[model samples]
Target: MPIVNFAVAVEKGKAHLDAGRPDLAAFLFGQVLEAHPTHPDAVNGMVSVLMQMGRADEAMALLRRGLEANPNHPDMRVNRGALYLMTNDYESAIRTYEGLLAEEPDDPVQLVNLGGAYMGIGRIEDALDCFRRATEVAPDYGGGHLNLGMLRMVLDTEGSAAAAEADFRRALDCDPNLHGAWLNICTLRRRAGDPEGARDAAEMALILAPHLLDYHQNFAECLLALGRRGDARKVLESLLQVNASFLPAELALAQIAVDEDRPAAAIAHLHRGTELRPQDPLIWANLAALLHRQGRIEQADTALDRALTLDPGNAAARMHKGRIQLAGGRLADGLANLAAMYDLPEVAAQSPFGRLEGAEPAWDGGPLAADLPQGGHLVLAPEPDESLTFLMFRFVAAAREKVARITFLDFRGLGPLAGQVPGIDAVAAVGDGADIPCDAIQRLGALPGLLPGALADPGATVPYLTPPPAAAKAWKDRLSALAGIANLPTIGLLWCPEGRRDPGDERALPLQQAERLLQVPNVRFVSLQFGPAQNELDELAQGGLVTRLGQHVDSPSALAGALAAVDLVIAVDGPAADLAGAMGLRAWVLLPHMPEWRWAQKDGAPIWYPTVTAFRQARAGDWESAVAAAARSLERMLGD
Candidate 1:
C-alpha cells in the first residue's frame, strides 16, 4: 500500500515537472525518495525532472539503471529518444523511435515526435513522410495535420496558394481550435487577395484562443494588408495591453507608427522595447533605424554598435552604422564601412555614385573644354543641388572672368526667371541663333537629383542628352516656374530627396498648402514641388491660387525663362533650389533637421549659393515652422 502511495507521490511530481514547475517537482520527488529509497516510481519521476531541466547526463545515468531493471519499458525508450532529440542526436533518436514504432505500429504521438527529429536533421522529405504516416495512423490528430501543412507550405511553389489553403483547411477540420492552422489559412487568403476571407480565418482563430499572441499578430497583419491600418493598430495595442513585455507586438506597433508618420511614437515604443529586450539584436537594430530617421544620429550609432556587439553577423546593423557615419560627415569612414558591407543593398546605396534621376557624371577632368571651344556650343548642365549649383555658377562666372574673349554660350534652364535676364554674351535659344559657328555643337544636360545612400555605376549618365540652349532653357524654365508658382512669391517647395524611401519624405505638406500664399497680402505662392507630388499640382491649381507652368516646356530654355521672371523662390532640400542658386536668384531653402552631404553643418551661409538662405527644420516633422519662417522671410522681402 505504501509503495502504491509512493507511486502516487511520484506521479504528482512528474505532473508538476510537465507543467514547468521543475523546482517544486524536484522538492516533491526528493520527499518521495527519502521515504522510499528503493521506489522505482520515485527514481523514474526524479529522472524525468532532470531531463526536463536539461541535465541530460544526470537523467541518462538514472535512466540507464532503471532500463537495466526493466528492459522492455516502452515509456523509457520514448523518454530516451526525446533526450537524444534534445541533444540533436537525430540518428540515435530516429533509431529509438523506429524500434518503438516496430513494437507499437499505431502510436500517433511517437510518429509525430519522430517527424520533429527528422526535421532537425534537415531531412525535410523524411519528416513530411513521417507526418503523413502519423495522420494515416491517427486521422484525427490535429498537430500532425498542421505539421504536414507547414511542410507543404515550404515545399510548395510560390503560386501554390490554393494548395496551402487546402492543407490549412484540413488541419482545421481535424481540430477546430488549431490556431496555427487558422493563422496559415489567413496568410494564404491574404496572398490570394481575398481580404474578407483572411479576416474570416483570423477571426475564427481568435475566437478559439483570444489570448494567443501569434493569432492576434496574424490578425493584425491581415488588417494591414486589407488597408485597415487603424484596425491593425488596435489589435496590436490590445496585445500590448495583455502583455506589455511582448517584443513582437511592440515592434509591430513601432513599424505602424513609422508608416503613419508618427516617428515620435515609434521612437517611444522602440525605446521601451529595446530596454525590455536589451539583448535582442533585432530590437536594437530597429531602435537604431527609428533614431536615425528622427535625427538622433549619435544615439542611433550607439544602438547599432550594441546590436553589432551582440550579433557580429548582423548585416542590418553594419549597414545602418555606415549610413549614420556617412550622414555625420565621416566620409572616408563611411565609405570604408560601406565597402565592407556592400553585399547588403542598403550599404551599396550609400555610395555617392548611386542611381540618380537623370544622372550624368562629368568626365574625370579628361579633355578639359574639348566640346567647349566650338562657338555657340551651349553646355546646358542644370545644378543638382543648391550647393553644387552655387559653386558651379560662381566658378563659371569666375572662369568667364579669367578666360575673357572665349565665346562661352550660356543657357538658363532651371528655377524662376532663369532665361529672362539674358546677360550672358553669346546666349541664344536653340534653332534661333544663326550667326553662331555652324561648326559649334550644343551640349545640354540635366541634374542627377540623387539622394543619400543611393548607388549607381561610376559613369552613369542621363537618359536625354542636354538639349540645345533654347529648347533646354524652355523646359527648365517651365518646370521651375510650375514648381514655384503652382500655388504663388512662387514658393518652390520640394519636401523630399530624390531616391529616398524613408519616412521623412512621405509626410510633407499637401499641395493645398502652397495655396496658403494667397492669404499673404498681395503675394502669390507657386508650386516648386517635384517628384511624385508633381502629379497633384494640376489639380491643386484648379483653386486659382497657383498656376502650372511646366505643361509645355520640355527643354531647359523654357524653364530658364520662367526662372528669370519669378520674384523670390522658396524650396526644400532639392535640385530646384540649386537651379535657383545657379541662376543667381534670391531663394529661401528649407533644410531637413540634419542637412545632406553638400549642405554641411557650419550654420552660416552655404558656399555654393550666395543668394540662397538656408532654414533648417527645428525638429523632425516640423515642416510647418520651416514654412512659416519662409513666409516671414518673404514678407520682409516684399516689404509687407
Candidate 2:
C-alpha cells in the first residue's frame, strides 16, 4: 500500500475505534501498521483495540513499542498506567502513576489514578492522602472531589460521614451529572438515618443513569429505608424485568415476598437466584431460611448443607441450621450447632448471651445445691413476656419454702401483678431504688436448668399466683349482675394470639372457628382478646356470639380478676392463657402444633399449669382441630 493509503487507513481506524467498533478498527489499524510500522495513531489504535478485547499482554507490548519509538510520549505512559490499573496490576499501576506524578506533581487526574491503585492494594491511608491532595490541587475538579468523597466513606470513622457528604455535595455542584457522587451521598445519608435525603439523592442518581442496575437497586433500598415498601417493590420488580438474572434484585424480591407472607413466591425467587448464582452461599442460606419458616425441615437441611458446602464458614447458615435442628426436636445436635455459633466472632457479637464474655470457667449443670444462699435470694425477672413471668412466679413460689426471704425484681413494673403472689417478702421494680438485702442472685429463666429435677416434681403443681382481693371482688360482683340477667355459664374467650413476632405462625384461630364454642348451648362468651382486634370483637358482637370486656381488662391485676371471675377460660397460646393458668382458673389452653417448648404436655395438661387443659393442633398451622376440641370440652363442661 502507498503512504497516502496507509494514512487514510489510520484515520479510518481511529474513526472506527471512536465509534465503538474495536474489531473493524483493529483490522484497519493492522493494515496501516503493516505498511508504516511506527505510526503513532495506528499503534495507539491497535493497543486500544487489544485492551478493549481484554488482550492485556498484546496491549502492553504495543504500548511498550510505542514508548520505545518515542521514549518521552506522555500519552503512551498514561495509556500503559491505565492498562496496568485495568488488569488489576496495582503495584505496576502505582509505580507508573507515581513516576508521572514526580514529573507533574500537581496533576489531579494522575493523583486520582494513583489513589485508586493504592485503594486496590489496600493502602487505604495512602489512598486517602492521594485523593486529598488531588482535591486540594484542583478544587473545581468534580472527579477529584468524587474520589475524595468515596474514600472518606470507605474510611467510615466517626465524623467521616459528614466530610463525605460535604465533598459529594461539592462534586455534584461542580458536575450535576455525576451519578456516582449521588449514589455515595445516598448511602451516607441512609447510614446517617436521613432516609428522605437518601431517597432524594437516589432519585437523582436514577434520573442521571436510568439504565444502571445499581442505581435502581440504590433507589429501591432508599425507598425501603423510608418505609415505602410498595414503591420499593415496584422498583425492584421493574429492575428484574430489565435483568431477570440480577442476583441482588432477585434476593430483594424474595425478601419482600417473605415479608408479605407469600412463601411460595419467595421460594420461587430464591430458586431462580440460586440458578443464576449457584455458588453463592448467601442465596442458598436464604433459601434454607424460607424453607425453615415453612417447616420443610428436611428440605431446609439439604439447602443449608449445600450452603455450608459452598462456604464452610457461613455464620448465617450455621445459625439457621442450629435453629432448624432445635425446631425438629434434635436438642443435642441443635446445642452443638449453637455451641459452634458461640465460637464464631460475628455470632457472639450479636448474641444476647454475649454479655457472658469473660475468662471465667463455664458452669455445666452440676451439683450446685450447696451454692444456693440460705438467707435471702434475689430473683431477677426475665423479659416481660407473660409465659416467662408466670414461670418465674412458679420458681419463686417453690424457692420460697427453701430460702428464708425471696424478693421479686419485676423489670417491667408488674408490681400490681407480683403483689398478688403470697410468699414474696417484697416486689420491687428493677430500677426503682428498692434496696433489698440478699446473699445470692439468680435469673428467673436459669432456675429450671440450675435445679434440674426440682421442677419435674409433682409437688410443684399448686397454683402459686392469686388475684388482688378488691379487684377480684369487683369482677365477681359485675359477673353476678350479668349472670342474673343471662342465666348461663360465663366463659372468657381469647380466640386471638397476642405478641406474635412471626406472621407465618398461625397460632391465632379465626373468630369464625370459635363460633363452635359460641354455638354451644347456654354459654355467655366474654372477650379476653386484646391489642387492636376491636374489629374482630365487633364482628363477633354483630353475630351476637360474644361480648367485649377488653376495655375493662387493662392491667395485669384486672386481667387476673377477669380470669378469676369466669367459670372457664378458652384461650390461644398467649398472655391471657398464662394469666388464667397462674390464677388457678380452669383454662382450656388451645395450642398450635408447635407451641413453645415450655407448653410441652406430659398428661393432657401442661406440667407448669396443672389446672390448664392443653388442646393442641394436630397439624402445623391448622387451628380448627384445636378449636373444635376446645368447643367439645366446653360443651361437656356446660353439660349440653
* Candidate that would win on lDDT: 2
Could you give candidate 1's per-residue lDDT for residues 1-640 as a string of tens digits? 2323666677788877765577788887878767765456666777778986689988888777767877777677788888888788999999998898888877887888888888888999889888889889888888888877777777777755666677677878888878778888877777678999999889888887675677888889878888899999999998988878878788888889988889889998888888888999888988888788777878889999999899977877776776677555564455445434545566345322232212333322122243444532223332323333333332232222322222323323332223332222344333212244422221211111111222232111111112235654554555455533444344434444341234546334444554444455655554444445555755664446655444443434443344445677666666556556666666667776766544543336554455678876777656666667766766786794
Worst 10 residues of 1 by lDDT: 457-466
Error of 2 at 277 (Å): 5.7
Worst 10 residues of 2 by lDDT: 359-368
Would you estimate the TM-scores of all the predictions? 0.67, 0.69
Q: Best TM-score goes to which candidate?
A: 2
lDDT of 2 by residue, 117-162 (tens): 9999899989989988988988888988999989888888889889
